[model samples]
Target: MTQLIFINLPVADLDRSIAFYEAVGATKNPMFSDETAACMVVSDVIHVMLLTHDKWRSFTDRAIPDAQVSAQMLLCLSREDKAAVDATVAQAAGAGGLPDPNSPQDYGFMYGRSYADPDGHIWEVMWMDPTAVAAGPEAFAAHDLTPA
Candidate 1:
């Protein structure tokens, strides 16, 4: 069976978070959404469940860390190409997210950028040359592969 990932995040404003995610290309899955939580579909196998603080408390007793001030983990997603990575970050900025909390990384074969949502959840978007990946490093030394 195929596995799907549901990233559960505690959000301060359900509506704002929904709008922010939507602006970055995720579609709201109303089937799993209510006032307390919303399921944002990022892809066929990727979903983000945004839960209100009160709703989050029901699942865990630990205090919800202030995402703006501290980070527990950094979430990342892949894109089709370099341009797609930039576009996602731009959309996020337009939606009130902080663009590039981290510096852009360009390894020629791989490119990555980041953005933080209004609630301060950092997400990295990356792209890698498929040909280079498939061919591997040895192929590059053999002059058989080059990143575009």
Candidate 2:
């Protein structure tokens, strides 16, 4: 079987997170979802497991951070162009998330924006040019260095 990746995140309310992800275009995956988790498929092989904090604790001993004031990770999505990035950010905002205070960045080959989910988890929506990226690693590195 081909490899797949699942990103498991602790959520205060599984149903709410599920609703938010669905609003942002993710589809529910019943195979890994239940009362404790709402699995949302982000791609053919990339799934997000929105587990309740209690259920999440069953899988680890670590404490879940208070997402209202802290961030544990940043999930990023790639887009086809700058407009796509803006649209994604807008969609996320409309679904209850808030746009990040940071300004957008435009490298020669890429552009991006960021937003924070209702729980304060950050996600970046970006657009990159494959042809420009293929030109050289320097371009990619240069793009990454630009302030966002």
Candidate 3:
């Protein structure tokens, strides 16, 4: 069986998070959804579990850090191409997500952008050229790293 990923995120507003995710192309899985939690399907093997703060606390005793104040792990998703990466980040921004405070990345063979959800969870959308990846790190050294 193929491995699947379920990323659990604490949301300040479950409904809003659902809407935000839907706007960025995820579909809701009602079978695993409730008033306190919503299952957002990113792809066949990837799912995002949006849980209300109360519901989240029930599962873990660790304090939920204020995302705005603390750095948590960044979640990244691969896209088909650079345009796809841009489109997802644009959709996220249009849906009230905050664009990354830092500049976008463009490494000739790779491109990426990031945005913050309503609850401040950081999501990065990226695209990497398969040929470039296959070529390996030598390709990176051959190209200019400076942003255009």
Candidate 4:
């Protein structure tokens, strides 16, 4: 069987989170959803479990850091092309997400943009040129990687 990923996130408002996710292209899965939790299906292999703060506390004793003020992790998703990446970011913003706080990244072969959800979880949407990828890392040799 193929391995699947389930990202469990602690949310302040279950319904709001679900709505945000749905607007960002995920669908709610009733099978694993309840009053305290909802399974957001991002793709066939990727699912996000949105848990209420109280429910999340039941799973761990650690304090839940306020995502708005803390750095936890960045979740990234790939799109079919550069346009798709940009479109997704726009959709996220229209759905109440914050646009990228950092500068945009454009590496010729790859392009990416980010947005923060209502709870401040960072999600990066990116796209890579298949031809460039097939050409291997050597194709990026001319790109500067040194710290300024």
Ranking by lDDT: 1, 3, 4, 2
Clashing residue pairs for model 4:
none
For candidate 3, give the lDDT of residue 9: 96
Candidate 2: clashing residue pairs, number = 0
- Across 18-86, the per-residue lDDT of candidate 3 in tens digits comes to 999999999999999999999999999999999999999999999998876666888999999989988
- Angstrom error of the Cα, residue 132, model 1: value is 1.9
Question: Which scores better on lDDT, 1 or 4?
Answer: 1
* lDDT head-to-head 2 vs 3, winner: 3
User: Each prediction's Cα lDDT score?
Assistant: 0.93, 0.82, 0.91, 0.90
**Candidate 3: global Cα-lDDT?**
0.91
Candidate 1's C-alpha runs over 4 A off are: 137-148
TM-score of each: 0.91, 0.90, 0.92, 0.94
For model 4, how does the per-residue alpha-carbon lDDT over 1-148 read when each residue is reduced to its tens digit? 9899999999999999999999989999999999999999999999999999999999999999898998689899999998988888898899899988545798778788899989999898989889878989887777774422
Query: What does the lDDT read for residue 15 in candidate 4?
Result: 94
lDDT value, residue 138 of candidate 4 = 84
| Model 2 agreement with the true structure over 1-148: per-residue lDDT tens digits | 9898898888887777888888888899898789999889988888888888889989999888887787677788898888888888888888888886457777767777898776677888888888987888866665456463
- What's the lDDT for candidate 1? 0.93
| Residue pairs in candidate 3 whose N, alpha carbon or C atoms collide under 3 angstroms | none
